[model samples]
Structure formats: C-alpha cells, structure tokens
Target: MSPSTSVLDMLSITPPGWGGVLITGAFATLFISFGAYLFGMTLGLFGALGKLSGIRPLQYALNLYTTIVRAVPELILIVSLYYAGTDGLNRILALADFGPIEVNGLVAAIAVLGFVQGAYMTEVLRGAILAIPVGQVEAAKAFGMRPGLRFRRIVLPALIPNALPGFANLWMSVIKDSALIAVVGYQELALAARVAASNTKQYMVFFLAAAALYLVITIVSNMLFSALEGYFRRGQRPVA
Candidate 1:
C-alpha cells in the first residue's frame, strides 16, 4: 500500500479500527480534566481560607496538606490514591451493609487528579489572597460587611485578577497529568493510543498522532488563558 493509503487505513473508523475510539478517548480526557478542575477548585477555596484563618491549628493543618501533596510525585499519588480510594470505598460500603461498589475508570481519574491538583491550587489561591492589600480587607471590615459579602464583593473579585494566571497554568498541568491516569487502565487518549499501537504494531504512528492531539489541546489552552489574562489586565498599567 502507498504510505498515504496506509496512514488512512490506520485511521479508519470501522469496527476493529481505532480512529473513533481514540477520538472518544480524547474527549474523555478533557471531561476527566474538567471534573478534576471543578473538584480541585472547591478544595482549594476552602483550603486557602483555612490557611488564612486566625486559628493556628487549622492553618497548620491546611499548610501541611499542601506541603504533603506538593512534595509527592503526581504519578505516585495517582496510583496510591486509586488503590487506596477503592479500598476505602469498599470498606465504607461493607460497614453500611451494602455490597462492595466498583470504582469506575472515570471516577478514579477524577478523584485522584482532583486531590493532586487541589494541593497545588491551595497555594495558588492562598498567595493570591495574600496579594490583596491589608487595607482592602480592613476597609471591608470597617464597613461592617458580613464575611460572605466581603468575600464576594471585595476579596473574590480582587483575587481573581491576580489568581487567574497561576490558575490557568495549574489547569494546563492538570490536563497533562490526566495522561498519567492511563496507568490505572483509564481509556483516555494516551491509553487508547497505546492500545491501538499494541494491536497494530504501529507504535510511532499511533504515538505521534496522540502527541499531535495533545499539542493541539495545549496550544488552544494557551490562547484561551492569554485572552483571559489580557481581559483581566485591561485598564491597569504594568508596574515598573
């Protein structure tokens, strides 16, 4: 077969063909990453708040959480969490007199990735919060604004502009880390490509295609974040 024809055959989408499966896996990767981002954002928000609180113990605990997560290798964390999470869930179910529940691939991916990303995000958010001038927070308090109101009106808006660049970088890192979840047998883009290569013995082609797809995702993400950063910077002059 001509090289072009061979390449086309490899990409065919019929049964026993991997094109459709690989495409689906790519979307699955995106979905899992987004799920992790949402979970991490929630954890990060509370974790940052805890670190900023007046209570010494809470601050120490939150700091400890961030330190442990940041220090661990992401792949090690994912693998350990996958097995441990499943075991913990089963134990909980057994205690409740329910049958053992299976941990699905997507669920495992989200759980592990979220916890890992949340640790980094905690630092990102905490730094952003600290970047806000003390006067701003004090001003809000002086107005007798409720805690929630102060956070919503004064703190959150200010923090967002400064936090966005760091958050955007972390978001990209989460997407890349999703590739590691393949070790847990999740059929994400990288895993699918590996399967296709193993079956067809076209390792270079399959992996190169997967790399292309990842590059596209990264480029698009960069563009989106750049736009966001520019939008946030509008009307503000750069400090010398």
Candidate 2:
C-alpha cells in the first residue's frame, strides 16, 4: 500500500486490498477446526470406551495419553506434534525405500490439533458416559439387547444430553486453537492478519479485524450449540 492509501482502501475487497485474503483465511480456520474436532471426537469415542473397558493395560495407556496431553502447554504440543508427526511418517516411508513426501499443511494442522483435542474429549465423554443411569443399560440387557444395541439405544441417547455442553466447549476451544497453526507458517486468519499488517503497516487495523472475525465465529457457534443442546435434551425433565 502507498503512504497515501487510506485505511478504507486497504481493507477494500478490490485490487491491492486484503479483505479477500482475510476472508479466505477465516474460511480456512473454520475448515481446520471442524476437521480436527471431528477427528478428535472419533478418537475420543474409542478412548473413552477403552478407558472404561476394564482392561488394565489399556486403561493405563489411555491414562498416560490423557495426562501428558492435558499437562503440556498447547503451543508446545502443536509445534512438537506438527514436526514429529510428519517426520515420523517420512521415517516409516524411508524404511521401505519410498521417497519422502511433504505432508499437506492442512492435514498436519488438523492432525496435530485433533490429537491434542482428543485427550480433553476423552475425559469429557468418559464423564458423560458415567453419568448415564446404570439401570438403563441393565434393563436393556434384560430385554435381550446386545451390547452394541444397548449402547446405541440407551447409552448414546442418554450421554448426548450430558456431553453436549462439553462438546460445545471443545468446539469453541478448537476454533481458537486453530490460530496456533499460524506459528508453523500455515496461513490461517491470524497469519493472514499478520501478513496484512506487516505489508501495510496497519497492525492495529488488521489485528482488530481478525479479532472481530473470531468474535463473529464465537457468537455463531454459541447459537448453534444452544440449538443442539435443546435438541438433545428434548423430553428430559429440567433440573430442579
């Protein structure tokens, strides 16, 4: 931008303006967060089940996994996992005489964030599963329902209400956590804002724009989660 360029011109969507860049970055942020959250939820499901499965070794392993992940700073985890994961994959490929391939940035970002998210999600789900009434499962068993059927019909439905709030929180967390991907050079909203600020020398303007985008995301997410919670809690008695 020239010295004479107005802030409005710099933010315009047309030529030489970075509004388009910022919007694209915002979409990228959403994509990464959504993908990571889904991946984490999948991992958390098996993790929660294993933790509760009465297998000593499995429980210990999961315990260690959750403990280490939760204890470490998220930024440290992101940097470590981001490099370690791709390097580990290349190492395995090298053993077979295969050429090392560059992992896609989007995939790495999702995997790293998802791995971190899985630990918290596991505990959230475990607690929700435990909150389910034991009598419901026993009653299903008495009616000759198989374990899988029992979980599907009884446990899942019951747990959703209990877990929805935690799920909402995790969703919010991952959206913000996606910003850490910028440290690794992937161009999410934060990175986009930084690039714009650096080039235009309007740090405050670009950063506040990015902050507004994040606030919009948070507000929309809250409305969506509220609806989801209402849907899941249908027919349930309100807590007195």
The CA lDDT of each predicted structure is 0.90, 0.95
Model 1 lDDT on a 0 to 1 scale? 0.90
Residues 1-240 of candidate 1: C-alpha lDDT, one tens digit per residue:
797888778877875667887888789989999999999999999999988888999988888889999999998999999999999999999999999988887888898899988888899999999999999999999999999999999999889888998889988999899999998899999999999999989898889888888888889999999899778878878644
Error of 2 at 187 (Å): 0.5
Kindly report which residue pairs in candidate 2 clash with one another. none
Writing each residue's lDDT as its tens digit, candidate 2 over 1-240 gives 565567778888776899989999999999999999999999999999999999999999999999999999999999999999999999999999999999999999999999999999999999999999889888999999998998898999899999999999999999999999999999999999999999989999999999999999999999999999888888898755
Residue pairs that clash (backbone atoms under 3 angstroms), model 1:
none
Q: After TM-score superposition, what is the CA distance of residue 114 in candidate 1 from its true location, in Å?
A: 0.3
Which stretch of 10 consecutive residues in model 1 shows the poorest summed lDDT? 12-21
lDDT for 28 (candidate 1): 91
- TM-score of predicted structure 1: 0.96
